[model samples]
Target chain A: MSAATEAPLLELDGLVTEFRTGGAWHAALRGVSFALARNETLALVGESGCGKSVTALSIMGLLPPANSRIAAGRIRFAGRDLVGLSEEAMRKLRGNEISMIFQEPMTSLNPVLTVGFQVAESLRYHRGMEGQAARRAALELLDQVKIPAAAQRFDDYPHQFSGGMRQRVMIAMALACRPKLLLADEPTTALDVTIQAQVLALLAELKSAYGMAMIFITHNLGVVASIADRVAVMYAGAIVETAAVDELFARPTHPYTEALLRTIPRVDEDSAGLAAIPGQVPPLSAMPPGCRFAPRCALREAECEATDPALAPLPAAADHRVRCRVRAPATAAPRHA
Target chain B: MPEPMLEVAGLRKFFEVKRGFPRATTVTVRALDGISFTVGAGQSFGLVGESGCGKSTAGRAVLRLIEPDEGRVAFKGEDVLAAGKERLRALRRKMQIVFQDPYASLNPRRMIGKALTEPMRVHGVGAPGERVARAELLLAEVGLPKNAMTRYPHEFSGGQRQRIGIARALTLEPELIVADEPVSALDVSIQSQILLLLQGLQERRRLSFIFISHDLGVVRYFCQSMAVMYLGRIVETGPIPAIFKEPLHPYTKMLRDASPVPDPTRKVAMLRIEGEVPSAVNPPAGCHFHTRCPHAMEICRKAYPEWTPLGDGRGVACHLHKV
Candidate 1:
């Protein structure tokens, strides 16, 4: 889809985010880097406390200002640097050019306000559409997201709608401004499996329909396979593996990614036992000195425990990359600018 | 089959809810409607369904945690519902439950050792000193450190807390454990650890489990037989691998197809059914799933489908399956 030659819609070069905890700053995201092509769906896959959510928050400029800070790195979005952007400028850009939908739709939505008003409010604030025009647009967006009887349910408050329907309302509001980018963090995790499929399908359709690049953050690899064009597997606050969706599934290079794939019980096949990752994720405050994953990695060598690995492209496929000292060592030079 | 560990028949639990602002009319919420299943000795029977489909209610009702409206729950041929208070209390020793949220189920202020041993203390299983030793042994069996006994529930991670919950359930040496979504709250990596631990315990202890969960993959992995519930009714019930391979009921088929497989080769099927699950209070007239069933007919909408036995312990309730 002409994404190859086009400039990346968003790029993060060595992004580091830290939070002040117990009088000390601990990095949650350690030098994370990725480039999102226009209209591409990049799935950020990781377990909790692995900094996937933090990456999304960093991009949205929504991190808690009191304790969290973007210690280092540049977040360039649509030809503009967002790391140091003022709140006023970011606010205008947020709903207009970038929007996000959270996991719990009920919490994200205002219970007091009607769903229609919430959707219309974004249009009014961002696009200057008012009154009847805004209402009509909001209803149309809801219909687009396949909210059944959208017009009739327009005046209903968030509490009136079911879990799946509330998620649809959230999507409609996020899409109201017709943003260029959408950051969705576990948008369907709370819904039932059937409803999750519905929401995922809706997201895929809308992503293509709007031609918007999306950063879908989720711990579910199944969801990644369904929606992602590319995937970045994060582990202990670092991108351990990155590849096209098919390639990542076919040949997961990073030990963490491989272990994770094996750990999940598959619906399609039967296995004797799930291969559990040996230990829990290291807490941010007590992160390993060298390779973050080395402590739990099966193939960890002595060298891995001494120095962290660089994220380098694989020799077989240039697009596929992994941050592992043993698996995909930095023998080959960096190819990307 | 060794008289089966547990047999539930016509289990029903209903709650009356008052709705509306000014005039609240009492409506019966049929959380569990005449659902039944049997868990054989050392067998794991999965009650699979979405939220509000009564899987959780059935689990609780079987244990008499929620009194059933109309049902016979026989634990090793002993009538659980008809048992006396003293008899029921004794029966509870052999049938423990593991809740979905371990954190919520556990007393945060209580020490992990105390939580583990308190049940034995209540049941008068052993001396106070012996209970403490049993608690330590249980912790070791669940792969937690003996020292973990001294820590509070809040100190441990979600996975560790779940292990503690498992240990507490085993204090009475229960034959049947009603594990309700035990791993659903944990991360995928941690989920596998818990699953493996549960499997190990089931194998070692010969524990019969009423594993209630919405995850088809997990249910398929752990359960030998399963009952797929929809709107408080069993739409399909059969042996796993087989039922999952060729699901007879439309609702079961939809659920299987909707479950996202890890492999990207098989694209998630376009949802065959539309609209969220109808509220239990106002479930559709005849067959509860008729409204959303892809192959629903006039007959399905007119009368609830009878459970047609397909032999070999397999059955389905659907108009299309009628002879």
Candidate 2:
């Protein structure tokens, strides 16, 4: 096997990304870590301002230098540590070996450039393929993403395409280089529900056909269950739990995950009433010590109030695991086939 | 149901768009074209559609925030359009509105206490201390802390700000409140909390609410009756259970399928709404949803379908459902 195949496609080890704001260092990601295998789809699921997108940006080296910094961590992709990589080196690595598709296409893509040029510019720069060759590749990628009239509409600008079509162009641009890893950050939030399903299905098909490792970041558990192979629940910049999709949905170990899951409206449910999470997410600057979710968690214990929980394997925990001080001794087993 | 709390018939509002430097030819954005619905006393009615479907316009029309070119809004057996300025202002005290953007709706320069009390002051209800006590009670009803009265809008989070907006609306103690996309801007977990609060307040106060939103799931959970709007027209009007379980109109079905349910294993059959919603400035003839409707017949393209009742109180304007 090749070295890239032997090693994980992307491996993060104890990644700590901090921001220096108001003259005090605030750690957004506290020793958060995970590994992405080739052709695997891992979902980073959490509520708003939960550091999921920040984690994605850290991987892409796109964080603003003024406020944020990677205090300490190892971001290894295909056996290369990206922590200390030069700007030029990182720029070269981006959009070629690795690519990212942000949340909103209308904002992400340049309004001044043609859709074709936006996609082909990366091909021309990364692969040094110029003129007709790059243009041809761009059209082919658009067609692959199921954009209609790709040859004719490649000249259209970002505003000309509808929300769903613009997102397709974004996907086409991200897949131009056939990158080994694709980081999608809330790719379907701006689109309407029907359009969201189409984009998600397109991503699933494209991931399988290209065998690309995808880090799908979102707050919607429904999206995760439909597409994710494994799920990681994050809170206050920490991976509170990780498990197979079915296992996590059937039985969430962390109190935060359980509360988050219960708060969502279910398809099978017929109740006219909503089950609400009582409190809002705590601000990062004034987060309480110990369990970050203690204020909102229903089953919070005294132990949860005194000590910070670390990711650990419960006595009967499956490959599934939880990061909490007072987890039940018995692992939450799969309840569904 | 005792003449209903509010009844709208043939409501239409067309905005004349000015174009070019000279502003020669005018284009009209048919924001609301002959839409109708009724909100029963102490009942919560939902108006749902995608962004530009005129759901907000319908809510505003009911409150007379915007004057309609044609149609009538009968509020408690009296016509709102025919009411004089003094009468309208007097009627306004009975019908209030809670806007969608809490941050923008409330004056940023004003304190929460002043914002809440100002409405009651204008209506000339009670003295200062009584108003203050009432405002504090309303704030507590919406779940904001008592100390929140002294703070500014910027100091509060989205959910808290929304509660302040609710408190301000409750200051009037109106029988009907027009809530326009009240919780869409907040996060999902926080959205549920606001919904529960609204539901609780609606019950405890026996307030009638016309809830306008693009989110079908939230509407299904919160509203007993719902009207599905499309391009400034009501395509489906029925009870929530009937509409969700057996949606008669194509657009209604598409909307139902579009909502993201929490169940991961539920493979929702793919039913997409074709093309972007047609601009309200130049809507096609016949059915408003005909351009994108999958079940559109030949007659639907050329002629508008009349409101057809489907045995029960449920009514739909689709040709396929007509009998």
Q: Which candidate's DockQ is highest?
A: 1
Model 1 accuracy (lDDT, Cα): 0.91
Tens digit per residue, CA lDDT, model 2, A268-317: 45654567877877877888888888888888888787777677765665
| TM per candidate | 0.99, 0.93
Question: What stretches of model 1 exceed 4 Å from their correct place?
Answer: A335-337
User: Scored by CA lDDT, what does every candidate get?
Assistant: 0.91, 0.85
Across residues B116-176, which tens digit of lDDT does each residue of candidate 1 receive?
Answer: 9899888888999999999999999999999998899889999999999999999999999
> What digit string (tens of lDDT, one per residue) describes model 2 on residues B181-299?
99888887888889889888988889999999887877878888999988898989998878888899898888787666655666444435455567788888998788878887899
lDDT of 2: 0.85
Chain A TM-score compared with the true chain A, each model in order: 0.98, 0.94
For each candidate, the DockQ is: 0.75, 0.50
Which run of 10 residues does model 2 chain B get worst, by summed lDDT? B267-276
- Give the 10-residue window scoring lowest on summed lDDT in candidate 1 chain A: A328-337
State the iRMSD of every prediction, in order shown: 1.1, 2.3
Name the docking class for model 2.
medium
